[model samples]
Target: MRVFAVAEIKFGELDPVSIELLNLANSIKGDGTAEAVVIGNGISKYAEELAKYADRVWKIEDSSLENYNPELYVDVLSQLFSKEKPDIVLVANSSRGSEFAPALATKLNAPVITDIVGLDTSNGIKATRYIFQGKLLVDILVKDGDTSVFTVRQGVFKEGSEVGGEVVDAGIKPSVTPKREFSQIIEPEVGEVDISQADIIVSVGRGIEDASNIELAEELADALGGVVAGSRPVIDSGWLPKDRQVGISGKTVKPKLYLALGISGAFQHIMGMKDSELIIAVNKDPEAPIFGVAQYGIVGDIFEIVPALVDKLREIKG
Candidate 1:
């Protein structure tokens, strides 16, 4: 029951999902060992950090892999897996993971599953995945002798605490011609506040309605000494920065207080913020799904509720 977790690094730092994959591997290892593969140029620097969660960390450094190339990643990982022949392989269900996992599975002649949210080794490698746009969950089982590759959904697993482990520099630099060349990464314009790090987040959605109305949410956030964020609708409407968007397509946040305004609470949105310690939702429709996970629910028009809430907060402060 050897488990191999693929480590993904961004901007010279290990992506949070990479650690989550290692944690998931630890849970299902079942007396077997867990290891991680760190791949990229100069990424060996992170071997010590990854070793905390993995029994063994393999640093696969290569100048060509400094930037992620799906073709190159699949090629390199395939070669490594061929010799390692681990029982289970875990990768994050992120943009990079979605692209690399299936391709790697094909090369390795293994069974691959995507967007898995739960894992259970008690029943011989069974996993829970969502279907019908995340409305339903179905358990899938892999027959014996089938090497399993999984693209695990982000934010679904907790990251394990740092522990002592061994680091091994595989010293495997793969040389292969790629049809595509690595290119420059385009970054979004920076904003004043990184909502992901904020302790309290006031998130707006289509219920905010107009761009000018964002000031209302901002006022509420200011009163609470928090930051303003929004759902995809607000970002797509150009009312909020992309970094401030909260959902699977956006940033996964675990703020102490998550105040959702006018959000209908789609599962994608829930997946990101459901981990918040306290969630308060205000929407005109009482049946909005946001209320499902909310600790407090206010059924009313946000336009009317926000102003009153802001006034009370200001009064309390005075």
Candidate 2:
């Protein structure tokens, strides 16, 4: 058994999703070698960093492949796989991974799986992913061929912590021209605090209603010595900046304590913060999916409940 894990990098740093993929590959490799494939300009150092976890690292560096042109990436990787085929390939379930994996699988004529939360390696490769807003877990198996491609969800598995593994320079350059050219990357304005770094996060959802009501949640967060965050709905309504949003498309936060106010739990949102140590959800709907993973649930109006809780906390602190 041999595993080939693709690594993703952003802003000159390797994304944690890549490390998680290595960890998953290690878990599933029963006495098999786990190798890593990293692509991009100036990614040789990252290959060395990944050497700790992977048995060997395949560094694919090209001037044109610097900024992620999907066509070029697919063409280049397909050429590499033709010469060195592995039993299993793992990719991160990120924007680049989602876009690249399906096309690569098509080129390789292999089966593809996305957003896998669990893996059952006992009987072939059984992957588990959620359906219906995280309410159900569906397990899928690949029976088509010896090679299978997977796009793993972020923050689901812990990153591998080993170092000093060997590095294999793949040194293959395909003569492929892309129809699309690389462009500049636009960055969002930096906020006072990054929610991903916050230990205690108080996140609001549609239940907050009016934009003015956000202050109530903010006050509660202040009293708790934490920061304010929101679900996609709150950010979509412009009550909070995009940086304060927590979800799959947003930021993934594994805070020490997470307080959800007025947000119904969707799988996309849950995927970001499900690894949080303690989750407290407040919603009027008792059947809200947020309550399922929450350690504590409050079924009530956020308007009435948040202020009361804030006042009580202030009094206790006084």
Clashes of each: 0, 3
What is the lDDT for 22 in model 2?
A: 87
- lDDT per residue as tens, model 2, 221-249: 99998999988888889999887888866
Off by over 4 Å in 1: 192-199, 222-227, 232-238, 241-254, 266-272, 284-289, 299-318
Residue-wise C-alpha lDDT for candidate 1, range 25-120, written one tens digit per residue = 888888888899988887756888888898999888877888989888888887777777889999988789998899999888889999887889
lDDT of each: 0.86, 0.84
lDDT, residue 269, candidate 2: 88
* Candidate 2: 10-residue stretch with minimal lDDT: 155-164
C-alpha lDDT (0 to 100) for residue 52 of candidate 2? 86
Give stretches of model 2 more than 4 Å off. Answer: 132-135, 192-200, 216-228, 232-238, 241-254, 264-275, 282-292, 297-318
